[model samples]
Target chain A: MKKQRNLTMAITGFVMLLVLHGTAYGLSDVFKENIYVPEKLAPTDSVLKVAVGEKAPDFTLPSVHHGKISLSQFIGKKNVVISFVPAAWTPVCSDQWPGYNIVKDLFDENDAILLGITADNIPTLFAWTNQMGELWFPVLSDFWPHGGTASKYGVLRSDGTTERAIFVIDKKGYIRYIDVHNINKRPPLESIMSELKKLNQ
Target chain B: MKKYFVVVMGIVLCLVVSGSSLAFDTKPPAVGDVFPEITFSIPGESDYRTYLGLSKGEYFSIQDIKAKVVVVEVLSMYCPHCQREAPRVNQVYDLIEKDPSLRGKIKLIGIAAGNSTYEKKVFRERYGVPFPLFEDADFELHDILGGVRTPYFIGVRIDSGVPRVFYSKLGGFESADEFLRMMIELSGL
Candidate 1:
C-alpha cells in the first residue's frame, strides 16, 4: 500500500509539471491581445516646448532623395505622415519602413506624403535607401544634430535616439494622429488607417 | 529488518526534503499584495551562480517595498517602448543612486524574457542604464508578476509582509515621471 501511494504521488507530480510546461508554451500568444494601445491616448504634441494644435515646428533636414526639403514645403497641399524610427538597421524599423513602402500608394491616394526620419547619418540612410529599392518617399536625416526632428516632436529618447513614433499631420499642419509604440511591437496599421480616414473625412 | 526500516525512513526523509523545494507555490502579486521573496540568479563575468541577488528580508503582505518603494521594470530586448524609455529609466536610476536613503529602499530591476547576452550587453551600453536587470527566460518569475509586455512597470510597497503592487503597466512612455514620483511616495523612506 505504501509503495502504491508513493508511485501515485510521483505520477501526479510529473503530470503537474507537464501541465505547467504546456500552459507556459502558449503564454506568449495568450497575452498577445493585450499588446495594443488604446486609440484615444495617442502622444499628440508639437515640437519641443510646443503644444498640440499649435503649428508644428518646421526645419529642413537632409533627405535621402538628393536635396534637402523643408517640412514647411508640405504645408497646405499634402497631409504628411512622419514616421520616427530609432535607427536605420534595427529590425523593427526595417519591417516598419517596408510596410510603409508597400502602402505608399494608399497614402498618396489619401493625399498624404510619408517621410521616415531617423538619427542614423546620411550615409547609412543612403545605403539603406539604395538597398531597400528606389524609395519614392524621402528618408529624412536628423543625424547631424541627432534626433532634431524627434526632439521637436517630444519623441526623442534621452540617449540621443528617436523613439518609434508615428504622426499624421493634416494639410493645415494641425496634428491629426499620433501613435508611439513599444519597440518590439509593430505600429497598428489599422489604427493609423482609421485615423487617416477621420482626417480625410 | 532493523537496517531495512532505517533505510526506508532515510528514503522518506529525502523525499520530503526534495519535495519541499519542488512544491513552491508563489502567488501573483496583485495591486494590493506586497512583493514576495524575489529569488533569482544574476550573471557575472565568470560564474552564473554568484551574481548579486536582492537581499531576502521578512516577507511583507501589504503592497510595499522591503526598503520603502520598489520599481519593477519589465523589459525585453525587442521592445521599442523599453528601448525608448531605457535612457529615461537610466536617468531615474541616477537619481535613485544619488539618494542614500532611497538606495536600497527604492530599487530598479530590469526583467527580460530571456534575452541573449550580446543583446543585453548592447542595451546596457547603448542606454547607459545603471540598474541591474534580471533575466527570466523560463517565464517563471514573469508568470508570477503577470507582466504582458516589455517596458512595463510594477510599483510595490514593502511596508507590510508581502510587497503590494501599487501600479502596473505594460509600457512606460507616457507615465515615466509620474511612475517615479509614485515610487518615491510609496517608499515611506
Candidate 2:
C-alpha cells in the first residue's frame, strides 16, 4: 500500500507539471490576432506655436472614451501632460500612445494626467486606438475645426496635422515644459520623465 | 516502500527545479556572456523560411543559427522607438542580404518583449520586417536579456562556436549604414 501511495503521489506531481505547462502555452496562444494596420511615414516639418511659461490654451474636444474633455478642468486640480501626435494610424502615432499605456503608473506617480490629442476624427481615433489595448488616459480628437487646438499651439502642419509635441502644465495653469519633437521621431521617454520630475519639485 | 518513496521524491525534486527556472527572475545575460539559450517560434513561418533560410516548423535558439555575427533587437510592438526604428532595422537586414561578403555570415532577429504572438504578427506585418521576430509573451527572454529598454540591440559573435555578446545599445542607431558598419566591426568579420 505504501508503494502504491508513493507511485500515486509521483504521478500526481507529474500531472500537475504538465497541466501548468499546458495552461501557460494555451494562454499565450489565446491572444486573438488583431487587425494589421499599415504604417504611414509622418512629415518632418513641425512648427512650435507655444512656449514655456505660457498658459496652455484651454479647449474642449471629443474623447474616444468620454464624450468631451476640456483642458481647463485639470488646471487647478492636477498637473496635466498634453501629448500631441501627428495623426492616427501612422507608425509613430500608433506606437506612441501604446507606449504611454505601459507608463501610466509613471504619470500617476508624478501626480499628472495625460491627455492624448490627435487631429483625426472620433471614428478614426476609435478604430485606430482599439488596436492598442485599453489606454489609461483619455484620447481627444481635434478633428472638426480641423486642427484648431494644434493651430493655436503653432504645431499644426500646413497639411492640418499636429506636430509631435508634449506640454507639461502645472496645477496653476502655466506650461512648465514644452517639447516640439520632429514629426518623424518619438520624443524619448526619459526626457519627459526628467521634465515631470522638475514639475514635482 | 522506501525505494518508492525515494523515487517519488526524486521526481518531485526534478519538477520543482524545472518549475523554478520558468518561474521568472532569471538574471538577464550581460555583455561578454554567452547568450542564454531560448526556444521560440517565429511568427509567420513562411517569411522566416524564405527570408532567412530557416526550416519550417522548427523552433529557434540563439546558439543554433549558422552565422559569424548575430544582431538581436529587443523590442515591443507598442514601443514608439521600435516602431520608428523598424524601417531602419529593415535596412540593416537588406545590407546583410545584399552584401556578397556578408551574405550568410550575418543574421538579424527581433524579440518582441512582453508581446503576445498576435501582437507580434501585427507589428511584423505593419513594418514589413523581413527578418524573423518572436514574441516573449511571458517576458522570459526579456528578463533573461536584462529587461533593457525596447529598441535595444545586442550583437553576438559566434565565430568561436560559442556566442558571446559583444555590443549592446539602449536606443536606435543614428542610421542604418552606421549601425551595419558597427556590427561588422564588432563582429570582426
Candidate 3:
C-alpha cells in the first residue's frame, strides 16, 4: 500500500512538470508574436517627459526678462525648444548653453524659440547669464522649486537635478521631437538639425 | 487486517484517479485574478545546489503572494531596459518601504534571468532592492510568464490569480506610479 501511494505521488509530480512545460510553450509562442517596433513608437500615454506625438503639457515659467512666458504664449507664433540642463556652472552645460546661444540665429531661422531651463534660482541664473556674457535665450529658472519643470517633464533625477534632454514642440503644441541622451553623452547635433528640418518641410 | 487492507486500497485507487486529472487549468488570469504556485531559486546560494524542493507555507505560497496585488518584474541584468528601470523601481520600492501601512501589503518580485553572481550583486548594490530577487537561469521564469521581454511586468491579483501584461518593452519604466496605483486597486489593498 505504501509503495502504491509513493508511485501515485511521483506520477502526480511528473504530470505537474509536463503541464508547466506546455503552458510555457504556449505563452512563449504568444510572446514571440508581438514584434518590437524598429523606431520610437508613439507614446501610449502622456508622461512627464515629452513623448513623441503627444500634445505638450502647458506651463508658465518665469522668464529672465519677461515677467512670465507661458508655453501657450508660443503656441500660434513659434516652434518651442525647451532645453533641460542639470545646472549652470558644470562643464558640459557650459559648453551646451553656449552652443545654443551660438546657434540662436539658426533656431530663429527655423522659427523656433529656444529656452534653457535649470534648477538654478533666478538670482543664480541672472548671475550666470551675466558672467557667461549675456545669453540670447532666456535662461528660465525652475529654481524656487528646483527642477519643477524638469519633474513635470520626467527628466528630474533622484538627486534633484534635471537631466539634459531636448524637447521640441511645434506651433500646435504637439511634441515634434525629443532626444534624451545619457548624462555623459551629448546628443548628435545632426539628429537635432534633421528633426528641425522635418518641421520646416 | 483485512478491513485495513480494503480501506487502504480504496484510498490508493482514489489517489490514482485524481493524479490522472493533471491537465492544465485553461483559465487564464483575469484583470484582477491572483496567480498559481511559484517557487524560485534564491541567488548567491550554491550554483550546484539542487532545484528548490519545498511546499508553499501556509501564508507564503504563490496564492498567498497573489492574495494581494503584485507586480512581478522579470528582467536580465545585462538588459539596458532593466538597468534603466532599476533606478525607477528602486524609487517606487523606497516609497512603499517607507509607508508603514503599505509595508508588506504589496509584493514586487524581481526575477533576474541569466545573470551571474557579480551582475546580480552590482544590481543589488546599485538599486538596494529590498525584496528577494530570485535568479532565473536561461529565462525559465520568463518562459513561464509568457516569454515576456526583459523588463516586462506581470500585474496580478492575489485573490483571483489573474494576470495582465502591463509592460512589454524597455521604456515603460516611467509608468511605475501608474503600475503601482493599478496594483493597489486590483489587489483590493
Candidate 4:
C-alpha cells in the first residue's frame, strides 16, 4: 500500500516540479525543505554480500541523465564508483547525490566515474533528482526487475528498499572498496574519493 | 485522472503539513536572541586564518574572532540558491573591505551545512567565495540552527562576550549594498 502511494506521489511530484521549473526560484535552490522525508527506519538492514577485491557484478540500467548505462562499459577505460542509494526524497539520499555535483572534478582528477543507482522507476527518480539540482553523472534505475542490481550487490533491504552503499570498482573491474552505510546517516563522498585516489596510486 | 489528481493533492497536503511542522519546530535565533557558541575549524589557509585573527588553533568560535559585527551565511555548495548568491556575497565582502568604517570592524563568513571539507573547497573554487566558510559535515550546526533552508543569513553583534543576533533571513539577497546597509544599521556599527 505504501509503495503504491509513493509511486503515485512520485508521478505527481515530477509533474509539479516540471511546472515549477520556470518560476523565479533558482533551479538549484528549488529542492530545499520541499521533499517529504519519512521518519528514520532501520539504520543498516541488509546483510553483506559483495566485498573488496571481488569482481563487481555488471548490469545495465536506464538513465534519465544518459540514455542507458552499464557497469561493464567502463571496464578498462575508467574506474567506476557505483552508488546505491536506498530511495529518493529521503533526507540523506537527497543530500548525498546532489553533494556529488561539486566533486565531479575529484572524480575526473582521479580518472574515476560515478553511477547513482536506485530501486525506483525512471520517472520517480527523475522527479526526485530533478529538484535536487543538476547531476553531472548518470543516475540509473533498477526498477523493472525491481532491485535486481541491488539484490546482486546484497544491499537490498528486507523492506524492498536498497541500502545506502557505495562500491568502488577499479578500472580492471575489481571492487576496491565497499561502504554499505547506515541508512539514517549520509556516507561521506570524500571516503569514496580517497578510495579512488588509492586506486590511481 | 481522478486517481492521479487525488495523489497530487495528497502530496501537496503533505508538503503543506511538513512545512507547517518545520516552521513550528524551528526556533532559530531571532533578533536580540543570544547566538549560540559554536566552534569552527580554523581555516587551513594562512590569510583566512589571519583575517579571523587566529594565530594558531584547530577551532575558533564566532566570539573568538576580532570583529564587532559578524555576518554568517548558512549555505550549502550543492544549493543552487547559494551558488547563485555566491558572487553577490563576494561583492559584499569587497564592499566591507573597501568601506573603511566597516573594514576590520565587520567580518563575513559562511557556514556550509552538510558539506564536506572537499565540497567546501570545491564551492570556494567554483564560486570564488573570498570569505572563510566552515564545514558542517555532520549537520550538527545545521540542526542547531533549526534546519532552516539554504542561503540563510544571520548578522551577529558580538559587543559583549556573547554574540547577539541582529538580522536573520532565508534566501538570496537581491542587492549587496542594500544588504550591507541593513546589516550595518541593524548591528549599529
DockQ of each: 0.02, 0.05, 0.03, 0.16
Clashes in each model (backbone N, CA, C under 3 Å)?
27, 4, 13, 0
Candidate 1 local lDDT, A28-141, one digit each (tens): 221234322222222333334444467777878998875897788999999888888776654445535644554566687789888889888889888755544456788999
At residue B5, give the lDDT of candidate 1: 55
Off by over 4 Å in 2: A1-46, B1-73, B77-189
Number of the top-ranking candidate, with TM-score as the measure: 4
Ordering by DockQ: 4, 2, 3, 1
Residue A117, candidate 1: alpha-carbon lDDT: 91
Stretches of model 3 off by over 4 angstroms after superposition: A1-49, B1-189
Tens digit of per-residue lDDT, candidate 4, span A87-162: 8766567667766876788899999898999899999999988876678999999887989999988999998889
Q: Give the C-alpha interface root-mean-square deviation per candidate.
A: 10.3, 10.6, 16.9, 10.0
Order of models, best TM-score first: 4, 2, 1, 3
CA lDDT, every prediction?
0.61, 0.75, 0.58, 0.80
DockQ class, candidate 2: incorrect
Q: For every candidate, give the share of true A-B contacts it also has.
A: 0.01, 0.10, 0.05, 0.18
Candidate 1 vs 3: which has more DockQ: 3
lDDT of 1 by residue, B39-82 (tens): 64433432212212323343222233235666777665545456
Per-residue lDDT over A1-201 for candidate 3, one digit per residue giving the tens place of the 0 to 100 score = 677667656755665454433322111111222322222212222235557899988777887776776788898899988888766654334435543544566687789888788887787667655544456787787876766778777877676667778899999999999876655334544456667778989
